[model samples]
Target chain A: MRFTIQRDQLMNSVQDVMKAISSRTTIPILTGMKVEATEYGVKLTGSDSDVTIESFIPVEEDGIVLVENIEPGSIVLQAKYFPDIVKKLPQQTVEIEVDDHFNVNIRSGSAEFHLNGQDAEEYPHLPQIQTNQSFEVPIDLLKDLIRQTVFAVSTSETRPILTGVNMKVESDDLYFIATDSHRLASRKIPMGGNVQPLSFENVVIPGKSLTELNKILDDSQETIEISVTENQILFRTKHLYFLSRLLDGNYPETSRLIPDEVKTTVYIDTKELLQSIDRASLLAKENRNSVVKLTTKENNRVEITSNSPEVGNVVEEVTAESLEGEDLKISFSAKYMMDALKVVDCEKVNIQFTGAMRPFLIRPNENDQILQLILPVRTY
Target chain B: MRFTIQRDQLMNSVQDVMKAISSRTTIPILTGMKVEATEYGVKLTGSDSDVTIESFIPVEEDGIVLVENIEPGSIVLQAKYFPDIVKKLPQQTVEIEVDDHFNVNIRSGSAEFHLNGQDAEEYPHLPQIQTNQSFEVPIDLLKDLIRQTVFAVSTSETRPILTGVNMKVESDDLYFIATDSHRLASRKIPMGGNVQPLSFENVVIPGKSLTELNKILDDSQETIEISVTENQILFRTKHLYFLSRLLDGNYPETSRLIPDEVKTTVYIDTKELLQSIDRASLLAKENRNSVVKLTTKENNRVEITSNSPEVGNVVEEVTAESLEGEDLKISFSAKYMMDALKVVDCEKVNIQFTGAMRPFLIRPNENDQILQLILPVRTY
Candidate 1:
């Protein structure tokens, strides 16, 4: 392949695909990125066994000359060293040429590098998914859903299916739920589109892949189209495509896990509660094995306290806007409570509970669609 | 004991002394900080047996009201938890009170903490150094000297003396040197006296203590006094007093290791050479062991190359400003060279050598007192 392209354009394409390049050297060729030139533009691909990313850069955009080529071919170059070199090149335009034997040469300014390239024929191919089973969602909403629920997924190896986020789609709404058996988080958003009549439920997507996809996705409001097959799932944008394998096991039914009614409801400013939890955590560290206690009396004031025999005790009286129902006292992991509160981007939050041992839900007062749940620790 | 202090002032003092606090719980009391309320002010002390730091906060500074007291006494509290609590307190001033049984109560707004405090009498006392053998030095100059020579100290415990920086003083000059078996660094500066005459020959200060001392010293031109004793050395400023034990052994004579004659010399831009060294290291990384080769010709161009059977080879030409004496080629650790160059605050440096097998020196053109020596690796 012989081509000349803008240095920044090539760097951006390399950065996107480089995330999939394997650092393990068992298969040396997998550490390389494949570059192919056709009549339309240049395409780059990188993959490990579990995930693959492919990005395409067109020859021209508006009046800007992005890529100029005289021949069309393909070659594989080391991804680890290629990006650093391209970023530090002295010239604005970079020239890449490959010989028939796949030896690649890159030149910019007075500096040149000769890298031993592998044959592109040895590269793995990407899986194809049927477009009929695909659905579209706004990128902002998708990233928000992932950030809210992915952290609650089980990281331990007890139950393999629990390590993934349950993604369910029905008619016009998408619901995401993740739980580690100890605590859970759930979020739902309404996205109207052409409905696929088949109901899809309990589809497990690994939390690892969802987190990585969230990081690489930019803050653009453009829609991302996703297609799912029996074994693989694909995310497609205008210029990029990402694919990952689906989990093999069945996800647990969490529909009955959420409590039906709340015994006590309290409305507190999110910032005030978060700060108090952080302070209460100082004493709670000694009890990394225990939970922080929260007490609400007949009035609107709530007291947060943590006690450890060796470190003494801390108490903070935080005034809430209002408190109702029978007076209640409960204890829960300070870390879990902090995690649930941070995802709530609102001024006020409503915390609802059924009992000391039952799961409690926290929701943004303004946006009630998103909910966070925590299992309270039973202490005598 | 009872006192009220500004949160920020208490936090700063706690953080500074915490550097000397022991993280290892061998002796439980060593992990805590002692706070004493005196007629003049309040003092905080933290010690780990190797080093001790005592910081004093007067009754009033610039009308900051750092401390106000109703009674005088002392107590020791766990250093790890006190700082975190004070930093998160909601009020501007924190009120602290000690009961008859030694239990302490800290209060700010609606937040209160009851800590288990240890008796102050159980804490180790700070050492007192006589001022008969003391001298004054600028804070910036002392920190610079430590940065220049400390990295070359031997990390192995086999040679305990070599793990410290050797300080020697004459009638009008001060010298500092450090060496591992493989490399050495030396710096010298002329001294003037508004002080007493000092003719100390050899005092070795532990490299680990110097590292911590340098971190706490600000880049100010104010003078601080350093006093030495048979087993300890003390650095005292207006508000802080630091004491460290001297390494127990005689330092090796390092003057014989420096070469007296120059065979070949070359001048290279500091930043230009550093970047090239970083690039050449990429190919070197793939070898059985990464090693880079350098060759200097009479034509003022230096060549850098590295090769691995599995990764191929890379070579680049870097143009030097000038060359003198015999043509030369030498190879050393890229890491050592990078470390040496990073501390040099000069634009152009002159690299001098006696022979290919002997240790070579890197020194700036304008100032020739400080020199960095690196031993060439025998790559058979």
Candidate 2:
């Protein structure tokens, strides 16, 4: 493989592909990144079993040449130092050549590096998802969907199925939900498309995969085509391809976890409540779960407090916009509450509580598309 | 104890004192910070046996009331959560009150915290340094002096003395030197005024202590008074007192390690040389010390090359301002060379090499105050 490429373009592609590369892969060849030079452009691929990322640089685009002098071939170079070497090369352009013996030579300015590369044939191939079940979503909306629900996924290994976000589509509506038994996050978006009778469910994506994919994606107006099969899903953009394996199990039904009746409802400024709980959690962090209590007070006021036997106790009074129904007191993980509040991104939030023990729901006062539910801790 | 202090001022003092507080201290009281409110101001102190840092906030400094309502008393609170609480307080002013039973109440805005406190009488007292050997040095200059030589201190605990920097003053010259048996960095500054007949050669300060002190000292033109005694050295600023125990044992003689005779001389841009070696060391980092070989090429060019059997080889040619004497080849740790180059804040640096196996010296072309010496590694 012989190709001369612009250093900045190559660096960007390398970084994008590197998001899927992990050093702990059991397959030795998977530790390397496969580089192929074709008549069209240069393609770089990095994978670690669960997720595979491929980035392509076009030979010429929009009156600019990103890659040139292509002699079609392929070689796999160790991903360990390849990215750093390409980033630190002291020239605007870099030339990479691989001989028949897989000896890779990279030259830029007055620096030349000769690395031992393995034949690209040894690298595992990414499974092809040839299903016609595909849909398009705006990149920014997709990122927001991932961010809103992914954090609620279970991090514990006891329940492997809860470690992924369940994505479901029904006709013209898309829904995403993640719950770790104690807390749940759900989001739904209307997909106005030509579909009249199309529905697919049970597509669970690993939270880690979504996190990495979210980081690799730029906030743009471009639409990403998502194709899903029984065991795999592919996210395809203009010059990038991201593939992640689907979890092989049924996702639990979480709709029943969110309480229906609102025995008590409170409206408060999001920032004020967030800051009050944040201060109360400072002492609460002395405990394991960082538990903090919220109690309704007189005159449309709420008290957020936390106590630790060895540390101390903190109480913060935050004035609420309005409080209705019977007065309520509840205790929950401060971390969970903070995480839920961060994604609301609104001036005011409405919190509904069925009782102190039942799970409560919080949503942006302006929109009901995003909802967060947290199960209160019993602190009698 | 009772006092209301400005949050920003209290936060700054808490951070300064936190530098000396370590959770691993054997003494239980050392894990707490002692706060004493006097008629004048509030003083905060934290210690971990080896080092103690104290910061004072005057009741009224320059007509600005930093602290008010100060009732003379003292108490020790756990340092683990105190700093975080102070930083996240929900008001500009904070009120701290300690009851008769040693329960501390910290109130700000509508938030209140009740913490368990220990009697201040149990806190370790900072030793008094009543020596007449005291001198003043500009804070910026002192920070610079510490940074120029501290990185060369030996991290290995086998030679405890090498883990500290040797500080010597003679007549009107002050010198600082540190070495780890392989590389050495030395800096000297001429002291003007009242130092015509004073000398102290046995003072050694631990590198770790200097690093912490350097972090706490702001880059200002104000002078700091440093006093030395038999066992401890005290650094006193207008509002802070930092005391560190001196490292015992005689420091190794490192003056002879730097070669006086120069058989080869090369002058090059510091940045160019640093970037070239940084690129060459990409593959070299896979090895132990990230060793890179530098050889003088024809036409005043220096070739930096590093090789790893599994990773490959990199060679970079950097043009030098001038190369004199016979052509030479030397191998040294790229890390050591980078550390030395980072401290030389000059465009041009002169490197002096005596032989392939002898130690070499590097210095800025314009100044002789700071010098770095590195020993060559035998590759054969």
TM-score of each: 0.94, 0.98
i-RMSD of model 1 (Å, 1 decimal): 2.4
- Mind giving the per-residue lDDT tens digits that candidate 2 earns over B201-278? 668899999999999999999999988887788999999999999999988778768777899999999999999989
The A-chain TM-scores of all the candidates are 0.94, 0.98
Q: Docking quality tier of candidate 1? A: medium
Which sections of candidate 2 miss by over 4 Å?
A194-199, B197-199
DockQ of each: 0.49, 0.88
Model 1 regions lying over 4 Å from their true place: A2-12, A24-28, A37-42, A61-71, A77-115, A194-202, A286-290, B194-196, B286-290
Q: What TM value does model 1 have?
A: 0.94
lDDT of 2: 0.92
> What's model 2's interface RMSD, roughly to a tenth of an angstrom?
0.8
Worst lDDT run of 10 residues, candidate 2 chain B, spans B193-202
The number of the candidate with the highest lDDT is 2
Error of 1 at A210 (Å): 1.0
